[model samples]
Target chain A: MSELELQNKKVAALASTETIDGEIATLNLGPTHPATHGIFQNILQVDGERILSAEQTVGYIHRAFEKLAERRPYNQITPITDRLNYCSSPINNMGWHMTVEKLIGAEMPKRVDYMRVIVMELARIADHLVCNSVIGVDTGALTGFTYMFQEREKIYDIYEEICGARLTTNVGRIGGFDRDFNKEFITKLRAFLKEFPKKFDEFGALLERNRIFMDRTIGAGPITAERALSYSFAGPNLRAAGVDYDVRVMKPYSSYQDFDFTIPVGNDGDTYDRFMVRQQEIRESLKIITQALENMPEGDYHADIPSFYLPPKEEVYSSMEALIYHFKIVMGETPIPAGEVYHSVEGGNGELGYYLVSDGGRTPYRLHFRRPCFIYYQAYPEMITGSLLSDAILTMSSMNVIAGELDA
Target chain B: MSEFANTIKDSLLEKFTKTSYELDGYGEHNFFMSQDEIHPAIEFLKNNGFIYLTDITGSHYPEKEGAEFQVVYHIHNLSENLRIRLKVDLSEKDVHVPSMTDLFAGANWMERETFDFFGIIFEGHPNLTRILNVDDMDYHPMKKEYALEDETRTDKDDTFFGR
Candidate 1:
């Protein structure tokens, strides 16, 4: 037998033994277990309740988004982005849209820019809501999760008012929103903005200072700032490690420079630090949303570019130039600049970046996503290596490794 | 390029003479180096304050002569608010590059995912294996020659949605 096989057999024999001699027990934590919160398996070597080692196996739902983007037209690829980090699909959609805009040099009107900020910030809030409450849930506080998730549904309603879908909201077009935000959207957004904080505060009060929640998270799975940086950590996790690097602040895109918000940092890069950073971030996202809505500019929602945006159908019937442009758009014949560009946004998870290489074709030659979850997940096993088995779930939940994002 | 970005470019040029590179728009440089120079270059840059390995991914150029795969690395210096792009070329027969996992433990799975998709092995990766794809998948799906959908998936007939 091979060494691996021999070792496995020996382990099996030891596991079956009635008279145990302190050999570490093996546990397949998930590919389907509830604790993981996603489709991923962790082979945990444990001694009673303390974890000895954790070997993670992701990609249970590996949809080749990068490869698929190569085949699909630039516009068609927007929907493909929707599947990555599905909790915050709108943010990915906007990020992809902006990346293309950067490639094409499409300048947007101020209104279109701020409108995007509102939608993107809402998506950020929704993502953090799921992550923070799910962290609470992982620590056996299910009631707080139920409370916070209801607020997420309200955010979903706001998304529905703007886009026709909620979950995988292919909400906007390349240059800007497919259509202008209506009065209904503004009303619903105002209601959500007005109402969400109360529920958020109530949810926070439930677990923020709860002794059990604090103990389960505060020092569990701690990582130093230097270690977190070496691991290329970003977003809240890096922020929790006391690094205040936010993409919105560092590399401001879509007029984020006009808005003011603080990047919350935590003392220790532990589960509690991750939790607190996200909680504070939700409040900051709300602030950005309010500012964007209040100072909402009055202009065209979509950029006035004939190349990216198709001419109106009425004009297409009357004008030859319009007809040709419309035809080109329908046939996916838009010309792409031949160059390489890397654009990043402060994704709900971290610095979500898209590195695009174009060959002057309608589609990208190569596209790679700097998926925050994927990068941060590498540090997961190391972080959970010596912690109690129960804390492993908290660390995983705090990392917010969405399977769709992870596998993509 | 900004003066700060140019300073970084000049410093690298002064240190590693005759290294191939391209100027990226964001005031950063994309140094096209050889596989052998990747480790030394990263080590030098790490000492110079580019502490974070922001991302590691592969870009395939099947049509380009001599270079079939390009392993791209984005290294960041948070203190200076500067980022640099490093690309190393690999031909079809030999697609090996030194792993960055030893330098940055966060590179472990990113390198594995790249290997899973592109079959470009990182020589010193501690446990390099297929990530984000089933191990049983024989072919690397992200190669330029590979089609996006499986040819055997017959239930869907030219429909965007499987429905």
Candidate 2:
């Protein structure tokens, strides 16, 4: 319609507000909005440009992962977890394996623990890079995203070197890793460590102090610390709200206590603060990775639990004992202690936990993943209630609500 | 359990007469409380140091006699760096339990997910409906009575799959 028709419609809407309440217009923001970056549907009740209320409808991609985990064996469940937070699959995989190890009372070597720290910190950096760059993209800054995403590809290359898969990496095994860090992985990582800071600084300079970006995100979608904690927020979102409640700092899993780092916090829990918190967290992750590499212990990469970890294909064909171990592992006949354990890791977005219950059976009696995305996405409507439509998109992006993790 | 965890356990036992405590494999404190006492217990803990609600999920057991469904809550005391687990048992016939929505805003979706997957009802939730599944879905998928595998298929054998 022309501008005259638009003016006529506005006049007509205003004239009708004498009977109805303020002429509220319902706008559908997503189910497939381009800015959403995932399948999130929001029904917004808007009066002109200001949002009065918003209702979110998720679960368009529900796959029932917890139900699937009940039938699969302990080792088979790792692949299922790979899809939960696809941005940081290594953390989920490691969290599940650690939960099982906790259940069966398997003590991993120091070398395995250090190696996991390195891999997990790398995943954290990759996860934060995706989140921050997307926040830039949502603010109409596409150049920074394109530049930083190449850095994310380099991180994926390191993942490919370790696990032979890019995204949805089933990287580690039950006891430890499938194998140690190969020479290609070490070389790529050393090169990345040497060169990433310079490229990252360039990317940061583009958006960290840009006046346009600041004006767009400074006060958009703000939440107070009290409200954030009451909503059970975690990770960068919680830290952005001024809560120092990081799982790595609080629980110290996988020898995280050995590494020295700082928990960055922000006073305002807006989109800008969330972005800044993640930015500092990437720096901390680099520090932890450097520490882990410098103090790397010397030992076997995997634990000595033959029943849990599969034997080599060569050994399985050559030796009877190796063949028997392989058969037991493949057939899901390994003895799992009947117990309940909840193990959590500091995932890319938040605390990704695995709550597993075993009844002395091959499969878990019940397995529930404490998906951080699923938990924190509940507060989106509350955060974006009175903000502009564009600010709502920026808030969702900064929250890093991956659809796979949200719907799993 | 650590000294701090034991202190919290002792405080809970002293306050609630019927509550009991056990240690899990990871040495985390596990408290068993009655369904009626859950709200008060959580409120008390919240007033004390356990301010953060980590998770809320449910598990089901068919062969168990009286208590077939267990609703679990993981509450975290972030300042003290201590974690605790609480379990409340509900039978198959009556699965009603109080909602934590009044205390934590995050409980809205977690409780809905629990109700959607296990059919356990959180009675006082403001908008308790199916989440992570279609609105018209009839059955709870996570309950043990529902088999994950296709029972009608004849091509696969259970023995070969080690079921």
TM agreement with the true structure for every prediction: 0.93, 0.95
lDDT per residue, candidate 1, A238-283, as tens digits?
A: 9999999999998899999999999899989999999999999999
Q: lDDT (CA) for every model shown? A: 0.86, 0.89
For candidate 2, lDDT tens digit of each residue in A1-408? 632254356545544553244667899988999879999999987776666667789899999898888888888998998898899889999999999999999999999999999888889999999999999988888898998999999999999998999898998899998889999999999999999988998888998899999999999989899989988888999999999988897888899999899999999999999999999999988999999988999999999999899898899999999999999998899888899999999999888988989999899988999988998998987788666778989999999999999999
Candidate 1 positional error at A35, Å: 1.7
**Candidate with the greatest DockQ versus the true structure:** 2
Query: Candidate 2's error at A142, in angstroms?
Result: 0.6
Query: In model 2, where do residues sit more than 4 Å from their true spots?
Result: A1-21, B160-163
The lowest-lDDT stretch of 10 consecutive residues in candidate 1 chain A is A11-20
lDDT of 1 by residue, B66-119 (tens): 799989999988788788899988998899999987788788888988898899
Q: In candidate 1, which residue pairs clash?
A: A30-A41
